[model samples]
Target: MAESSGGPKKLLWVMIILVLLSSAGAAAAIYMVLDERDDDNPEAPSEEVVESKPPVFLTIEPFTVNLADDRHGTRLLYAGITLRVEDEATRELLETHMPQVRSRLLTVLSGQEAGQLTSSEGKQQLAAAINERLSEPFDENQPPPELREVLFTEFIVQ
Candidate 1:
């Protein structure tokens, strides 16, 4: 009876020690993993401390010009223009040269008659010419201006 009781006591002590050892090992493993991760990014940025910038909003003024005389006579044409610039500096450059852009547009449009201005081919030609003229003022190394499309807001012949 004594031997049987001793055997059970020994087994119970062994199980307790094993349980404690396993728990300690698991804790050590978790600590090691966390420490390694912290070393990889020692100075992680805090969410609240990080700053974010707002998106920029850009817009261009619309253009209006008179077309050259045709069978229908002189015509007034209005166009809404939008330009995609690389950055604020490029935008400033464009604003500074707006008068030149306007004059070039007027010259190009004035050469066309009412019939030519109304046709699809003529509008495409005008768009291409405007893009070309705009690129002339910017630095040669800089990317060309992005002209998405040209729209005729008003067209009237008198």
Candidate 2:
């Protein structure tokens, strides 16, 4: 009876040690994996640590022009455009060449049909056209203006 009791006690101690060793090994593996990840990506900035620049916008005055006849006798488009320029230099370039900018906008607006400007796709196409035209350099010697977006604040067709 004494030997049986001792045998069971020794078995229990062995089991407890195995469990402790397994737990320690698991903890070490987890620590190693996390440490390796940190070392592998040392330069990755967390979202909270990232910095962003504010947007710059350039607003153009409203335009009223005759749309394509489309056999509708007469049609007109009234649009207010705002340009999202890449930087202050682009905005200044547009402002300095206000006459040329207005001329280009008027030409694009007047060429659109009233029916085509009424839909969402048409409006997007119009915006793209405007962006393309505005991106052209005012001076052949200088780089073209960088336009991020062409937004129409107001659109009315009659």
Candidate 3:
């Protein structure tokens, strides 16, 4: 009776030892895989992080324009445009040609419709067109402006 009781206790201890060993092995394997992945990755976080220049933001005065319409009444669009630029030099360049930029924006905005500006796709297309027009050379010999993005801080149609 004593020997039989001891047999079960020994078996239980062996099972507990096996479970502990398996868990330890699994943990070690996971650690090794993660370590290997980090070593293999080129953009590892272990390297030093270099500080980058913040994007330059320039806000233009809001625009209120009558959208093209065929109905009995007029449709109006009000938008505040914010431009993202690369550097101080680019911003300075834009400042010098602000009049031309505003003129071009007005031309583009006047061509849009209330229904067109209401949709997201239409808004994006308008943004793209404005970016293109703004980035174009003011003169035949002048270089294109370095305008990164055009964001509408305020956009409304009525």
Candidate 4:
């Protein structure tokens, strides 16, 4: 009789544990379903609006550089550069480093041959070279800015 009673007590404890576990599992399933439903609803709080930065341009003063002259006589190239920059910060940085920038540009412009500076194709090539020069790392701490274009506002070869 005592053994039979102990068996009934053990069976009752196991049944209670199983019932508790089943209840917890059901509750978890319901919570997951509710979470998925919340995601499906369009009335949920949305993501924040990201502000966009506008395009900025920086213009450098005209460069009057003497080309590599030959028997054709002394030649000059007057080029005014306008940089289409990625941001205002870059333009500000360029403004701060104007002297160094000017020196680099002058070197580039003066290196061209008179014949090379005379044609439209030559001017385009010069612009591309300027673009590359403008984007070079000027400061050791900060990275170079993205340069969209190097436009020759004034191009005269004489």
Candidate 5:
């Protein structure tokens, strides 16, 4: 009877020792995984060492254009125009060709009625067309000037 009780106690002790050893091994593996991650990224990047690019500047000129046709039975036609151009060269090119731009815009807008211009989709289409026309003069090989956006500052039809 005494020997049987001792055998069971030894079995319990063996199980306890195995459980402790397994837990210690799992802890060691976890520590090694964390340490390996630390070694991968030994140094952090310095914020001060980074440099950023300067923002590009854009300018617009307000235009009040007169349409040829009087769709609304009135002679007055007014539109606020803005041009989005990139550098000085492109700006100069647009400035030099102001008469052409005006002519092109007049031709494009003259066909549209007051109701068409009032719609959001109409305005977006018009802007896209205008952008396309404006970029026509630039060489196809080189990147065209980035037209930021077209805004209708003031639109009046009479």
Candidate 6:
């Protein structure tokens, strides 16, 4: 009876030792796999930081013009325009020759038909026309001012 009890105790101790060794081995394998993954994928190079410049805007006073009587009778357009210029120098150039700028704008605006002013395409066309006209040099000797875009703040047709 004593021998039988001692044999059972020895078997239990061996089983416990086997379980502990297996658990340690599994933990070591998992750690090695994670470490290998970290080594395989080195940290990505940091992205380059770019310096961006702010846009410069020049606002023109609102314009009221008589639309062409092509399809309607004596229609009018009241539009507020803001000009995006490439630099301060172009804005200064426009400020210096405001009378000529207004004249050119009025000529283009007065020619637009009431029917044409109602659609988005017409508005885009109008902006393009304004851009083209404004891009022309104010003086024969000077180069044209760099006009980036023409934005309409308000548009009303009656």
12 Cα displacement, candidate 6 (Å): 38
Candidate 3 Cα misplacement greater than 4 A, ranges:
1-3, 119-121
User: How well does candidate 2 score on lDDT at residue 62?
Assistant: 96
Model 4 TM-score, 2 decimals: 0.64
Ranking by TM-score: 3, 2, 6, 4, 5, 1
Q: Which prediction has more favorable lDDT, 3 or 6?
A: 6
* Residue 55 lDDT in candidate 3: 88
Compared with the true structure, what per-residue lDDT tens digits does model 3 show for residues 1-158? 34565887899999999999999999999999999998899886665788988889888999999888846368999999999987888788788889988999999999988887889999999999999999898879988888899999999998
Q: Predict model 1's lDDT versus the native.
A: 0.67
Best by TM-score: 3
Local lDDT at 148 for model 1: 41
Give the TM-score of each candidate: 0.49, 0.72, 0.79, 0.64, 0.51, 0.69
Question: In angstroms, what RMSD does candidate 5 have relative to the true structure?
Answer: 7.5
Per-residue lDDT value at 92 in model 1: 74
Q: lDDT values of the candidates? A: 0.67, 0.92, 0.90, 0.88, 0.66, 0.93
Question: Candidate 6's error at 97, in angstroms?
Answer: 0.7
Candidate 6, clashing residue pairs?
none
Error of 6 at 7 (Å): 40
**Compared with the true structure, what per-residue lDDT tens digits does model 6 show for residues 1-158?**
34566887899999999999999999999999998997787585547888887898989999999998875589999999999999999999999999999999999999999988899999999999999999999888999999999999999999
Q: What digit string (tens of lDDT, one per residue) describes model 1 on residues 10-95?
A: 99999999999999999999999998998799487655766654433235556566777776766777666565555566567767
Report the CA-based lDDT of candidate 6 relative to the real structure: 0.93
